[model samples]
Target: MPAEADPASIDAGAALADRGHGHRNEGLAKLAVGAIGIVFGDIGTSPIYAFRETFAGHHQLTPDGLHIYGVLSLVFWSMMLVVSIKYVTIIMRADNKGEGGSLALLALINRVSGNKRWTAPIVLLGVFATALFYGDSMITPAISVLSAVEGITTVEKDFAPFVLPLAMGILAGLFAIQSRGTEKVGQLFGPIMLVYFVTIAVLGIVHIAADPGILIALNPWYAIQFFLSDGLTAFLALGSVVLAVTGAEALYADMGHFGRNPIRVSWLFFVLPALMLNYLGQGAMILSLTPADAAVAIQNPFFLLAPESLRLPLVILATLATVIASQAVISGAFSVTQQAIQLGFMPRLRITHTSASAAGQIYIPVMNWGLMVMVMVLVLSFQTSSNLAAAYGIAVTGAMLIDTCLLAVVLFNLWKWNRFAAMAMLGIFFAIDFAYFGANLTKVPDGGWFPLMIGLIAFTLLTTWAKGRQLMMARMREAAMPISIFVDSAANSATRVPGTAVFMTSSPDGVPHALLHNLKHNKVLHERVILLTVKIADEPFVEQETRCKLEDLGQGFHRLIIRYGFMQEPDVPEALKRLTGCGPAFKMMDTSFFLARQTLLPSSRPGMAIWREKLFAWMLRNAESAMEFFRLPTNRVVELGSQVEI
Candidate 1:
């Protein structure tokens, strides 16, 4: 067979293989660049404040060699272990159909668990983790921009008075442009961040060349000595040290945007090395100075690395980099909110797709403005990055701790790994997460209370919405008439119209309230009646072939179920067009979309507190219209309103 091989076949096979390899390489390169811009932004901007905060923060320490070496060692190992090993290597592998994040992981866990009794608590943990993410989303922009703008003070002492106003201005501008979309601006992010990382790496290398002793911080012994000698002081420094790895979760959260391999490659090769080098450079610079000079230099170590002539340019670059960082968090908040809405944990918000080619690039106006207001308030209140730093770590640490708990469940229950191995991994992650969380707790009296308060408020809103929705659905079902019963009773008697009526319902098996109201008020039914139910599955994406399922209930009635994953937005009309075996192709002008608008009347319900019910009512009242969220044609839509008490 080998001797008789056809020449044409051999050449074609070789060409195909070469093309495949080339395409793969190109795809990987593109993704790596994109991941560098989006996934690494928050952590990339950390060099602006992380090193300085450790030595000159709320719990300031003398910049002696031991203290400098110890803090650097802690920062280095924290990146290596917490970010590289725990998140990039381990947690990223536990993705749901190539999607990563707390909610995605929770959905995966729920799917695998088959609805066990313990699943409720696991789901709550994930929901709370998602809520805490909002707090992180708010704080990240405030602190990152403030820290970057604070660099101006180092350029010239007279610029100190402009710090807060400049930071607020930058943040306001960043949020202002969010609605117009970021597709254009986002293209430059990868290249800008690439330049930023390389510049920081070069700066670090130049400083490290002068004092090579800073390399000792790579050893574990320095961190050990730090804890052994300083006791409570060393432990407390962790509150600031945690800042170095703040955006590490973005690596996993944004994995769905970029694949695993690209993110891993970017982190190991570029991002990690640049960060460690910069931290070490800052440490080395501090060590070369006398105690008095080091104390002043530590106030803004990152900017001080540049020559006096270049400090102004460095500030400009830092400001741009911080804006990029803030953009990632804002975009992430939009993504997570969309997911929550689909998963039924939050109310629907207006979502605008900015890029037709990219599904992930979306804008939410309400979230954007709300975040901006909160961020500006934080900037004006804190007045400096150091004070804002105290509020940073709590939400991040809480989310990370929840991720560890969810990961343990994934390993032992889903992956079916060895129990001891899973427990061992869990123990290590729990120890680190608990320590960081505990350390940040000490800052509550200063400013840590801010994120904690945000987390609590967010958690309450999320859980209340979920519970209220469930109770409302149960009440609706109790009041619902069966579709079969309706079809049989009314098909022969009701007046038949010429067109199609698509009634949107949450429950597939019941007659929609809008349908009932239509029959009651109009005394007529369409010749072709479609009871449509949109469902969100526990996966990130649903295949097109399986998206719409049509069931013939007979007597001119058809049940259509449109399925979407949590990561997808539902388009009812688009799904309707794909439907087969219906009377004809769905024409927008010929079809009427029917929707039920519920007016919630808070009652003494066993499900939620009365105040929470009122809050749910308020949220329900403000939710985006179904016509808009489902992308239905405006003229073809009809809304039926009814009051429901739970």
Candidate 2:
């Protein structure tokens, strides 16, 4: 779970210039736009559920005017305190390299701890949280689209017949677009999300002006009253309510792309306030309306609160906003899975590149299909947006709780911030988030089993993949011919073909998986066989003066290991450029990057049990490929695919 994030180098321009682009500010801006835009979708759509579920989720509060006031009060303060204060204001600064996510946080902890003692438990928890996140990703679009489309049912009772299918169709369309990278589509996300906020705020304001007095739900008393009156139910209600603020984790995850500032400004100045005002307005309407009108109002509460003439346009705006929310969650799943694979928590798979310039833009065909299938099943099985809401928050709330724990480590252990100050701030966050987490627990039996089951399956797969890699690595090391011996032997017998072939490896002392596979399959060896391993030193960028070490073995076989800092991409080409003067002159056009492609096959050996083998295999088949992973040139890259039973 604690994957090393290759922190973004401040000298991204230097790397880009070598690659071709002279100035990278354009690419950087595009990256910022797409990444931040795609990331905000899930959290952006919370208003759809946050307020509605607070008043109507599993532990349904009375639709009475007073309860609505209390619920809205809880929702507004929760956003202000939990989403704005805890995350956007304070936690966004806790970034590793430029990368943000649970795994990134885990890496930061490892850097601070300076030991492997916390690795096992912390990593397991992070991977499980990531797996659960996929469940959230799948369900987000389903519920958002369903909830918005169900608006038709409010206008026409017969529209209920087509709501579920229509929602499924929209979800299917959304997933289908995964084959197309978000670079083009993502350009519109920020502005669109901005519009979504404005549209919802305007709708809320129209209602609030009609009944402005209900704005007093801003009082802390109503929020307290709800908890006192509903007792445990109010606490349980907090889980679904917290869904309004679901994207706080993504805010951290995408910090590197947006450089932490734009997102902070966007959330604090625009997104947060708009969301709160809308929720407050919803509360105001709910509090003023009679109980007899409760069912009717909530049926299209968001629209019902609006004037009759503007209702149709509001529906269109809501639908577009819902689409953006769904899209963002889907993209986050891709980024997280990529990190998981790199960290050794997941197996290898066929990841494809959809865009040329945007390295972050990738498409995983298997994952896309898998998500589509799950979303379809969820829609078909649940049969209603409200039912799907039951299962939605547990994974999201659980993730938020995990983030808090990770933040605690960052503040005290990493930053060495004062414990008294850190603990005081974190304690308030812990209480509020845990309360929401407890609220989500009430939803488990109702419909929350889905994410838990997915998390368990995912956790098992992740654990198995990690353990299997460890055992298999030990086996490979044991079976590997020592560098001195293999070179001595191959120096005499192996055919020396033209040009250089660098086999990037995990360990330079042992023979690479790709070298062995190439020699076995094609029965050809490059004239110069360079076994290269990139070691990460604890710095931002490794200096050229001491970037690499080259050992000249007998004949054409040589061993090279490049050392980098925490904040640099593993540019095989760049590393090759630095390796030229050390004895073997590497020519870019003439050289081929031989990469080992492991097709995971779960074996009943010391690595992974049979059940876990299936999970690892499934994960491998769904994972992104090594092509884009190592930033190798497509034509010059040769993949030696081999099977490893985990």
Candidate 3:
């Protein structure tokens, strides 16, 4: 809900500054609706496989008596505690500009923790958790779609082989339309999800009617009995039950898009109850089924729970719902990567916006393509939806653990909440999330490689970005001119020009790459050569007055620092506008933003090991343009090429 100035003007000044438009109400409504598409999609569509897998997957819990009731009870309470209470009721309220996610939580922590050593690992964990979310995003579509399509085989055994290819075709078609804005496709998500909820509820209620006693199974005792009765196998079943709440984190992630109230209302009033009912109904079905038909029963639990006549249409609805869930996660991946790059955890890549109204919904072409390839490979490799379940739970549980760690910091330091409150919340969630995460560890051998692989690659990229940034800063500091020398030498000799030539730089010590290279190549300097370095402070956004630290380095080269929080990107011209009143009126007419483009000399420097050196070079090649980074005008911008090994 960025303020509607001219889009062109906004982009020219700063990428995403909180210019919330007059459409607060409109945006809120749209955000709520779109959130259903993105945030709750995975969790909303969970009934498709969660129960089915718990009773049938590798853990091999048979559908019988207390096992059936106990598992259903567990799923119900898990959704209530994990999704509805924990996230929707509590966490979603803690939004940063209507945005809720790990980053938002981390931002809150940084504001609170100040100078603690915990900050570094907290940030790394947040970034890694986000990386894991991407892996889940890619896998969700493959598994969900594959599961829904596989329902076809139960209705008609001959159609079994076509499920994977059909799922692939649908996925291919789904991604093919990314260039088209979400406005059109997104409209269907709300009403379709609404119908989806009603249908699953109705289907489940029909079964629940036959056995009203099934409702009694919702108690914690049944859940405890299931744990006591079944032991490790039942405890391990949490890996699959946890799947039901997989996309619950999205509720927070898409908070900015929908706002807190809508998501809260939607999940609490509608989505939660419907999911629980459907899950309970699945349990009831197992209670009625004979042991011999148990394998057949778990294979298609939702369909089997319903009258045989209603199976096909139910399958269709489930498929659509699952597809929508997948769509949300994929979009989430794009958003997180964008945030990572802006905050310096990742290399910047092309971010293409398809919609004018929704700045949040962007298409990262590389991310989209990368996900599609991995998802397709997952579908082809895993084949069955049950196999993909192992990969799914571990990533989600890992993210949940990270969230708890960050929340502990938030409660204790950030919010300054009491130790008891912090400990109580952390202990409860930690125990729940950690147990499931530990349980999911067993999934590693059976197709869990998917999330692990994606997380490792993503973690590597993020760490490399940090290391590269350090190397760049170190190199700049080494080559920098001492302020005493620069003032003594250039202060009296240089000619003063008309306007500011803001040299976006890495360090304040030496002459900036742009300043040195501009003088070397063009033999000209502006009236004010402002050396600007935007440092991402621990907090979310920098305060206005503290935004810039200006030093008179004389010779018209003002060594300047534009400080920003990881949540804020510095706007050079806007920053210059504020700095103007300090001395003279600095107009845009004569001002230019100069940037230094460092093309790595395929190197033999003492900077890094050979492999890392090559990795940095590869990353640099794929990175977004410096002009774009500095928010510089294309016409007046100058990029002077320099060589750096690290």
Clash number for every model? 0, 5, 10
Q: Each candidate's root-mean-square deviation in Å?
A: 5.8, 4.9, 5.6
Per-residue lDDT over 1-646 for candidate 3, one digit per residue giving the tens place of the 0 to 100 score: 1122354743422222121222354554564555566567788778888888887887878788788888878887888878777776666555444456887676656554565776788888988887788788888899889998988876788998788889999999888777575777888998888788888898889888888789988888999998888888887898888988888788777765566666776777777888888988887777777888776788778777767687888888889988888788777787787677766778777777777776566787888888889899988888898998878888888987887777676566545688887788778888898888988988899877779888888887778777777787787677777766765665565555677777777676667766667666665556666777777664445679788888876566676788875544556777777884345766776778777878765456676677776787789878888677656667878777788755
lDDT of 3 at 110: 56
- Candidate 2, residues 237-320, lDDT tens digits: the string is 777677777777877776655656556666766676777778767776776777777755754566675676766666677778
Clashes of 1: 0
Off by over 4 Å in 2: 1-39, 485-504, 512-527, 534-549, 562-579, 582-610, 613-646
lDDT of 1 by residue, 508-625 (tens): 7788999999999999999899999899998887889989889999988999989998988898888888888978888989999999999998897688889999999999999999
Q: Which whole-number lDDT from 0 to 100 does residue 249 have in model 1?
A: 91
> What TM-score does candidate 1 get on C-alpha atoms?
0.95
Query: CA lDDT of each candidate?
Result: 0.89, 0.72, 0.75
Clashing pairs in 1: none
Q: For model 3, which pairs clash?
A: 3-19, 3-21, 31-257, 31-258, 32-258, 98-256, 100-252, 480-510, 481-510, 497-527
What order do you get sorting by lDDT, best first? Answer: 1, 3, 2
